[model samples]
Target: MKFNWGNQHKPNLFTLLFLYFLIVLIVPLGLFSAYYALAGNTNQERYLMRQAMNMTTGDASTVAQALESYRHKAYQLSTNPLVVEILKADSLEAESSQSRKLYELLFTVMHGDIYLASANLVSNSGKVRVSTHVFPEVDDLRYHGNDWDMASIINQNSQVSPTASLISIQSHRIAENGRQVVASILRRVYDQEGTNLGYLVVDMYADALSPQVNSDHVLTDMLLVDTKSFYATSLVHPERFGSFDRFPALNTLDGNYTPRSLPSDTSIIAISPIRGTGLHLVGSLSSAPFFQSMENWLSAFSTTMIIGVVLALGLSYLFSRSIARPIKNLAKRMREVEQGKLESREVSSAISEFSQLEHSFNVMIKQIISLLDLTREEQAKLSEAERKALESQMNPHFLFNTLNTIKALARLHGEEDIYTITVKLGKLLRSSIDNRESEATLEQSMALIESYLTIQKLRFADKLTTEVYLDPSCKHIKTPKLIIQPLVENAIIHGLEPKVGSWNLSVRVERAGERISITVGDDGVGFPPDRLPDNLDELANSPHVGVYNVYRRLFLKYGRKLHFSLKSKEGEGTWATISFPDEEAIKEEMQ
Candidate 1:
C-alpha cells in the first residue's frame, strides 16, 4: 500500500500559489482603494457642512446690520432740537405746534425700513405726538397708560448709547389688519440728566419684516434658536414661521458652532449671536452627498475582493481539497452561528485539528445560547416590576373626590346634562386606566379627545366652543392615547374657565411629509411667557400638569420626533402645538 498523508494524497503547489497571490496582492489593493475613496468623500462632506453653516451665519449678520443701520438713523432723528423741545415741554399743549412739526420731520426722514409701517413720538405722560398711519381714525390715537408702557427698554435714569430694542409701536395699521407688530428701534429721548423722557418708537410690521412672507411660508421657519426666542431672520423662508429651532444650531446670546449629529450622519450648525441683543443667526449643511459617494466606492471594493476570493478558492480546490473542505465546513458553521441558529453542523473531516476545532465551537455556541436566554428572562422580570411600580403611583382616591363634586352639582341644579358628563368622565377614566398599548391610532386618540371635549363643553356650557381638525391622512397613524385630551382639558380649565369672553377652543391635526402635527389653541387670557414652566418636571409640578403629562407620554413613545411648544401673549390667546412622526416611520421605530 502507498503511504497516505492526512489527505490520503499529496497536494499540488500551483493552486496554493494562486490563492496566496489573490489574498496578499488583490485584497491589499482593494483595501487601499476603499481607504482613498472614503477619505476623499469624508473631506468633501466636511467642506459642504462648513459651507452651509457659513451661509446661515452670513445671512443672519446681514439682518443684524440692516437693523443696526436703522437704529442709528433713528438716533440721528432723536437729536434734532425740535424733538427735544417737544419732549421737554411735558404737555403737548405747552408747544403743540413744535411737537406737530417735530413729528412730521422725523417720520419723513427715518421711515427707511420697508417693514417700518409707522413711527411715533411717545411721551411718558401718555401722549403719542405723531403716528404715520391713522386707523379707525387718525385722531383716534389716544394714549392709554398700558399702550405707553415700554417694557422693551431698560429705562435708564440718563441717556446712553442708542441700541435696537424690541417694542410695540402703537400703530392702527397692524392692529386693524389683525397681524402682530413689534418694533426694533434706534433711540429713546432723554432729559439733560439722561432721564428717559420718551421714546422714538420705530414700529416694524411683523408681517412686513419679510416683505415676501406669506401665510404658507413664513420667514420664521429658518430661525436658529438660543436661550432667547430670536432667530436667523435671513435663513427663514417668507412663509414658514417658527419651523426651525435655533436651539440646536447656535446660541442666540453666545455665538458658537459646535458639531452635532454624527456617526450615523454628519452635519454642522453655526450660530452667530447679535453683539448686544439676544438674537442668533444659525446655519446648517449635511455632508450626506459626500459620505454616500464614499460608501458606494467602499461597497464596490468589498464586492471585488469577494469575487477575487471566490476565484482563488476555485483554483486551489483540487490541490488543497482536504484542507479546503474542512475550512469551508468551518465557514458554514460560523454562518449558522451568526444567524443565531447556534446548533452543531455535521463535520466528518478526518483531520484531527479540524475535528477538535469544530467540537470546541459547538460547545461554546451552546453555552452562549443558554446565557442569552437567562439574561432575557431577567430583563423581562425587571421590566414587569418597574411597570407595576409606576402604575401604583397614580392616585385613585383624588379622582373619586373630583367625581363626587360633579354628582353634587348635577343633583343641586336638577340638570340632566351632568348625567351625560358623568358618563363621559367614566369612560375617560376607564380608557386611561386600561389602555395598555404603547401607542394607538390617531382615530382612537381623536375619540378620546372628543369625549373629553364633550365633558368640558357641558361643564362650561355657554363659556366654551370646541373645534377639532383632523387631517385626512393622519387619522390612522399611531400616537399615544390620551396625548391630546389632557392638553385640551388644560386649555379649558386653566385658559377658558376663568375668562369672560365667548371662549373658542380649537384643535387642529395636520400631516406634513413624515410628521403629524397637532395644535390646540384657545381664545382666552393667555399665559404669560415669563410664567410658563421651565421644563417638563416643572410643568408636571405646576397646574399645567396636564400639559406635562402629554409631554411625558410623547417622549416615552416617540423620543425626538415628538415636540411640544406654547405661544402666548397675555389678553390675546394661547396656542400650543405638538408634533409626532407619521405612521410608517412610527412602525419602523417600534420594530
Candidate 2:
C-alpha cells in the first residue's frame, strides 16, 4: 500500500475558492465582530464608571468645603472671650449676661445657615451653659453620651494650647428626631488666663454633608463614608446611616477611587478620598444602559458580517472562474496534442501570460506538423538512395579485380613498396564501396582509416608523418561505417596536402568516462580564421565534402548524443573530435 501523490484526487477550483474566501474573508470578519462586541461593551462600562467617579468627586469637594467653613466658625466661637467668660462665671446673673452675649456671638457666626442645626456652649463639668436650641440638663447631656462626650472633650481641650483649637467630627443621634443621624463638630474653649474651660459644639444635619447628584446624572448615587466610625451619608438612600461595613463591597474598597462590582445589585462602585478628611466618597451606577447600547451594536455588526461573507463568496467564485477557464481550455488542447493531432488552433485570452502561452502552443503545434512532413520526405529519399546503392554494388568487384591486377604487376616488376601500397589501397576501396551494413565495429573503422592513411603516406613521400592509436577496450564498439576514414581524408587533403614543411597527422581513440572519443589532429597551414562555417549547412556547401559528410551521418544517427566539434586557428593546427556514449549505453539508446 504505497501512497502516490500523482494519483491523489485534488479538490476542484470552486471548492478551493470557497475555502480560500472562508479563511481570508469570513473568518477574519467573524473575529472582528467578536472583538468589537467585547471591546465595545468594555469601553462603555469604563465610560460610565468614569462619569460616576467625576460626579462623586465634584459633590464630595463641595460638601467638604461646607464642612470646613463650619469647622472654622466653631474654632472662632470657641476662642471668644465672652464665651470663655460665660463658661468660667460663678454668679447666675453674670452667667446669664455672659450667656446672652455668647448667644449673640453664635448668631453672628451662623448667619442663618439652615445646615447648622444647633450651637451649644458646655462647661467642663458636662453642663450645657448656653445653646441656640433648648438647653439640655446635665443628666440629659450625659445620657446623650454618644452625641457629645464632655469628659473626652475637656480632656482633649486640656492637652491643646490656649491660643490653638482642636476640632472633632462625629456622627451622633439627635434626641428630638429619635436617633436621626447628625454630624457634630466640637472645638475646645479656653479662658483669659489660658485655663481649659469647656467645648463649643456645633451640630449639623448629615444630609447637608452628603454629596449631591448633578441633574445631568440623576441615576448616579454618591455616598460619603466615615472610615473611622463606619458611618455613611448616601445620596440615593439618605436614611442609610451607621456602619457602612454591612455592605462588604464598599467596605473592602479601602479609600482608593477604584471601581468594583457589587453583588447586591447590577451596579458598580467607585470610591474617592476627600483630602485632609478621613472620609471616602463612593459613586455607584447600574449597568443596564451600557448593556442596551452594546446589544444594539452587536445586532448591526452581525448583519454586516453576514453581508460581507456573502459578498466575499460571490467574488471568490468569479475570481476562480476567471483563472480556471483559460487553464482548462489549455489542458484540453494539450490532451488533443497527446492524441497525435498536430493541427494548430487559436486560444485567445485577456490575460497577458495566458495569451502568450496560447500563441506559443499554436506555434509549437505548427512547427511539429512541419517537422513530421519533412521527416517523411527524408525517409522517402533515403529509401530511393538505398535502392540505387544496391544496384551499384556489382561495380565494386570490377574495381577489386583492377586493384589486384595492379598489385601483381607491381610485384612482378620487383617494386615491393608499390605492391604493398596497392594492397592497402585495395582494402580501403573495398571497405568504402561495401554497402551490406550501415554500422561497423571500431576495429573495422580503424583498419579502414589505417589503410587510407597508408596510401596518403606514399603520395606525400618523406614529408608526411602519421600516428594511429586506438584503445583495445573500445576496439569492439559499433559505430557508423566510414565515420573515421572521411575525417582522416579531410586532414590529409585540406591540412597536409598544402603544407610546405613536414606535416604531422595523428588519429587517437580512447574511452573518456562513459564516452568514447576519436580525435584527428593535423599541424598544417590551417584555414583562414574568418572562413570557418557556422553550421553544418554552410560546411556541406563548402569544398570540404568529407568533413560535412561525416558530421551529417553522425547527426542523423545519434542527434545530440554525438559530440562532434572542429577547432582551428589561422596559424595553429586544427583538431577534430567525435565522442559518443560507451558501447552498452549506445546499444540501449539505439534499442
Pick by TM-score: which candidate is best?
2
Q: Give me candidate 2's TM-score against the actual structure.
A: 0.52
CA lDDT, candidate 2, residue 486: 80
Candidate 1 residue runs with Cα over 4 Å from true position? 1-29, 36-45, 90-100, 116-118, 133-183, 193-195, 204-267, 276-278, 286-591
Candidate 1: tens digits of C-alpha lDDT, residues 1-591:
232367536444445655665576566766777677657666665665465555555555665665566566667767677777677776666366775676568667755543444556666664645555532222222433245332233232122454334432222133344544433453667777777666665545554444322223311234423333333333244222332352343333233334221222344444455554445544444445556776787788778867876776675555466676777778667866776677865565688888888888877887898889999999999999999878875665567577778878887898778767876787788677774676777787888888888877776687677789888788788776778887787777777878886999899999877788899898888878898666666776676667788888788877876678888889878889987777586677889
User: In model 1, where is the ten-residue run with the lowest total lDDT?
Assistant: 212-221
What C-alpha lDDT do the candidate models reach, one value each?
0.62, 0.71
Instruction: Output candidate 1 Cα RMSD.
Output: 44.1
Listing every candidate in turn, what is its Cα RMSD in Å to the true structure after a full C-alpha superposition?
44.1, 10.0
- Candidate 2, 306-385: lDDT as tens digits: 88888888888888787778887887788778877677878789899999999999999888888899999999999999
**Segments of candidate 2 deviating more than 4 angstroms:** 1-219, 234-264, 270-281, 305-449, 461-463, 467-491, 499-591
